[model samples]
Target chain A: MNLARTTSTTKGKECEAVPSDGKPGAVGVDPEQLWLRPTEPRRGRRPSFSREAITAAAVTLADAEGLEVVTMRRVAAEVGAGVMSLYSYAPDKETLLELMVDHVSGELTVTDPPSGDWRADLKTVAHLQRAHMLRHPWLPAALTTRRVPGPNTLAFLEHVLAVLRPTGLDGAAKLEVFAQLTAFVAGHVGHEIAQAAVSRSPDRAAAEGRYLAAVAADGSHPELAEALSAPGRPLTPEATFTRFLNRLIDGLDTD
Target chain B: MNLARTTSTTKGKECEAVPSDGKPGAVGVDPEQLWLRPTEPRRGRRPSFSREAITAAAVTLADAEGLEVVTMRRVAAEVGAGVMSLYSYAPDKETLLELMVDHVSGELTVTDPPSGDWRADLKTVAHLQRAHMLRHPWLPAALTTRRVPGPNTLAFLEHVLAVLRPTGLDGAAKLEVFAQLTAFVAGHVGHEIAQAAVSRSPDRAAAEGRYLAAVAADGSHPELAEALSAPGRPLTPEATFTRFLNRLIDGLDTD
Candidate 1:
């Protein structure tokens, strides 16, 4: 009946609220009985700053500029709040980084895991993930899956498990399958973007032809050697990517 | 009778050499000449920088400091040379980058392609490549097939091709297989080293625990969730790496 009163510390200060073995306010504080002045039923919230809003703005800034320019003060300014106020939502800059990753994780759209053909389901998931990377190229560098998977990341994991459940593999086998597939997609996707970045680079283009010419003059790398000497057909990144992804998936399906 | 006396242009400079051609310096410059050295080879070169010395110093700099810090000035200082004088050996910074990567390539120890199971041979190449990455962590970021393969890299590729020749995959298929294996290994290795770097960050030790605790809160995703929480059964990088590699290789045996 008097749990709050009985739990007062020896210093006569209100200690951390503890459960009084099912007494009122014991474990769960009831919302209906929150006491307040008649004119205003409850306390007004702090300035409207949710983790979601902060993350969205951070993503925008990162996309517009780059990840290197993402600072706490800049994020706070983007969110229309003082830097100190923003710290209340995210404890530190690192915490903000984690939340930003979680935000991108929320963007992955999952499909109903397929039942009849596991290969199709895996491909669908792979393609969807590729699309996600294209949408937020910065996410991969920001969101790291270390010892734990965040909520949205777990949802992706859940989708993978659901799709793999129909396959004959057990838990360990399924886990291995997911790991390889994710690594394949992430690795390949990273390469694609990096190559794209370099393909546009003037330095890369200027150096590429000259180096090939110099080496092709006398060097011997057989295929490359011959190709360099000849008026060669360079493989398009898209063609290379298509061939690689299909073959890897095909190889995966057989085993 | 003087087929050797012809005018050619290369690098925006007209040259008087042998058979004139449209290509740069294509005055049929002596087929045997590696560098465009001064005619009477500059002797008494012992007191200053040499090409071998510059490349070796650059390789050491990349291995110790990251590639970004391996500036021309810094490298020249390391060799105790005037900055402009260093260029006499390296030609240019791009050439220096190429030489640095080529020097690292020289260390890749590979065997003749195996004659037995194709997948087995592929696995050997994969492991060897992984070892090279560990030996030179800055490599994946610096080197690519588009760049000249250098001598040892060419040998490694030849071994891979020889092994996969029996797999019945065409040129396109061979390229795909190689791309998948190498990109997967590079991305995975980069991710691993990145984790180590992040762990060493002053903030990670403090922030990492919070992120880990929140995500592994539930007994979630079963196997993945289990791996995250199992006491004294921490997933070591080597163990995880081997697991992924085995799965990928096992999946390839069907071909």
Candidate 2:
């Protein structure tokens, strides 16, 4: 039913579209149809399940498995619906992903207002985001694209904007800061999670160590060899995140 | 063949594996076999094509179309080989991806040595990476995983290590800096490319503007409303990148 036209009709929404993986022709979800419209089917008889149920199911699958396994058929099976029927709720996997992302963003509930120390407040914001992404590991990748902010995401964005109010940066600058901060956190957490997985597998970690040792011994990479030889105190992922976050946030110029 | 055993046997190589997509069980390519092993098939009569050709073809495909369209079968067809035969070179799409990422990295040729100003040098290193990722839009997603550094990637890494030598950061810190910088650039480019795509489509841009306007009008998103209303001097992607890069690099503490 002219899906392309329907999806292409909306743009410049809050969350950026999913990373296109360099696919230039990719179209993001229409915010109007996706967010503004009714959650249930308008014309058909009331179904036993709701869109929220479907989205929750998809999020569960992604959390347990990975984004790779959250297929339409798999998600349908989880919700006890036919694949075709699931189409009525989320036209495709992309739409389902949009739904899944927003569904999980519901957890980013910040009750306290900004503390007025913008940098300190922003650090807390990033920490909140990092923890949230780690809980729902699929989030960082899901966030790489343009996403229309669903109700939950909007609420979080509103809070972040309020936090930035003390900075006196223009509205656009505040928005840019939020987007960049989110991207930075996502990138850091994505790496941190992958590193954690490697650390979990002792065999893999040892193998990697040996592999690097061999490379260092090759003489061509003297700097690497020296770096490896005098390895300093190993920092935890949380420390690294804070270190980088401080650098990024502190470096932001209000002028 | 025991594929799992073969892949899990090697780790701690230079390039981190592809982003595990939060998949804990994901194993990276075996660096020894992938990088040190001969390019030609060891046993059988050497096939008509080389590993380099297969990787190049895959890269071309990914460049023209997104990473999603690059399948083993498609690559085989492009190289005029059977899909089964291609497996001898790259056992799976993951391995092929490892190959392709390193292959494109060959383009990141840095002729000058570190300029003594480690921050400036690191900034240059990041800018080079930003441009490289932009050229291969799929790189950001691919770099999300742990990858073994093949010869090309190793060559580039060696250059970066030299640049970091001035910082007096321990070898581990140097390595961490490089990884973080790469992730930051990938994250930025991924978002930049997606935003560019939206900008290219006027219809989509307008729809997004309308969607956000509606949200801003909803009273609940006052901060979003103000931010949208006064989006300051629209910054170019390059300027935004440079701004963020400065903050990140300048704020990096050598102590």
Model 2, A65-94: lDDT tens digits are 888899888988999998877766665678
Q: Could you give candidate 1's per-residue lDDT for residues A1-255 as a string of tens digits?
A: 111111111111222232223211112111111111022213445346666688789988876666656888899899898987666555456546665665676777476646667777787777777777656665545432332344566667767867765665555456556665666676666556655654555444444455445544544445444433442345665555555555555555323
The true-versus-predicted C-alpha distance at residue A231 of model 2, in Å, is 1.1
Cα lDDT listed for each candidate: 0.55, 0.79
Looking at candidate 2, what is the lDDT of residue A219? 83
Residue-by-residue lDDT tens digits, candidate 1, B42-152: 354443556667778888877776666688898988988888776555445655676666667666656564767887788777877778887777766554322444445
TM-score of each: 0.62, 0.90
Model 1 residue runs over 4 Å out of place are A1-51, A64-97, A114-116, A139-148, A167-176, A198-210, A217-219, A226-255, B1-101, B109-119, B138-176, B191-255
The TM-score obtained for chain B by all candidates, in the order given, is 0.70, 0.88
- How many clashes would you count in candidate 1? 0
